[model samples]
Target: MELATKRNHAGEKADLRALVNGQYKGDEHALIERIAADLLAGVSARAGEKPGAGKIVGLSSKAACREIASRLAEWLIRETDRAVDARPSCLPAARWSPEEVLERTGMSKSTLYRGDHAQFYSVVPPGKKNGRAYPAWQFIADVPSHLPHLLEILRSNSRMQVNTFFLSEQESLDDLSPAEVLAGMPFEDRQIVASAQQRMLALPVRARVNKVNALARMEVADLG
Candidate 1:
């Protein structure tokens, strides 16, 4: 029996040994979702093969390809349970260090230390005594500038709070994060941004006491 393969421009087999040597930054569900999407795309691209993905050229028949995809999905679901048993731990921080920010923004350490860059970026410290790490997403492409509204909103200079607010889903922004809405096209977000244009505010974590109290009426939520 042989395995499926995809080749690169150099005619070498592209590595797909993710099971053996992959450092996954995300969880298994997302990986499976991506695979599912890829499968759909490949199948749809083919003109007419009884309404399915193209036969794996390396395989004997179209049924084999379908079987492989089916088995892969089952495997993903089954493997997730085992992964839960293993209890892997990880800390994901999509933040850039001070030096990285300096290189990306063409600014100096002294400038950042002097707190002059606050208007231009969101800076969060990893912990006490550690210098701030900036969220790279805050910066637009090669612009020596920051959004005027973010400057005012993040004025409290509490990086943790500001990052949470921008990253969270906002009801006013149609369930999209403020950061995403800000980064998107103008027409779509014009009303929301315009409505928010006059305000200078800060992000803070709010405790939903009512929701917490409602836990007695339903199954306990996964706090973690």
Candidate 2:
């Protein structure tokens, strides 16, 4: 009996022997192998039917095609969602190097990273390079005058939490994120401060205490 054959656009026949022996590689190969198997099954079923018997070959092929289409559609959807979610949305849109930060703020490295109590919020991004990256949102027009005040308000939170705070929308600030509220051309510093204070206050007492305690523990560990 003739085995099923599938040809690529280049008119090259796929290795049905290798595919049947489960020696194929990668998802594309596996999909092609499954399709080949389906076609072979349809052919075998037709060969078994009597010469005058009503054929169900079309129905079998249609069912296999529908299944392959559904699976392919689902795979595509999952891949698209994974690609979207893989994007770095949690971090600020702009991460400036120390050189860029110095260019923007004209602050000396010592002052920029003055031990634990640095002038600016910074993070060490993952990788062997292991250098600091400053979120550009903090330096909207050469570091807003109220930056220190905002940092002080959120001292209990870690740098990551602080970043999250700025990006998060606060209803108290008319549903705008702290970054957005503060970045406004004619924003009231007091209003932004109040919104931040309200957000901190709104946290559960236990959560606030836990975060503060966690920060304290980290500091103590650093000292040791």
**lDDT for each candidate structure:** 0.43, 0.49
Model 1 worst lDDT window (10 residues): 9-18
Q: TM-scores of the models, in the given order?
A: 0.36, 0.38
Q: Write the per-residue lDDT of candidate 2 for residues 85-183, one digit (tens) a residue.
A: 443212246778888877654556775677222335876665635667877666542123335545665677777777766666555545655554444
Per-residue lDDT for 1-224 in model 1, tens only?
12333422111101111221222224545455445445554565663544344455554344554555567657645644554354322212367787886774455677666653344555546665646777655543211222333444445545565566556655554554555444432222234544342221112111122221232122122221
Worst 10 residues of 2 by lDDT: 9-18
**Over 4 Å off in model 1, which ranges?**
1-93, 115-117, 122-129, 142-148, 185-224
* RMSD, one per candidate, in order: 17.9, 22.8
Q: Local error of candidate 2 at 60, Å? A: 99
Off by over 4 Å in 2: 1-92, 115-118, 126-130, 185-224
lDDT of 1 at 125: 61
Q: What is the lDDT of residue 107 in candidate 1?
A: 51
**Number of backbone-clashing residue pairs for each candidate, in the order shown:** 1, 0
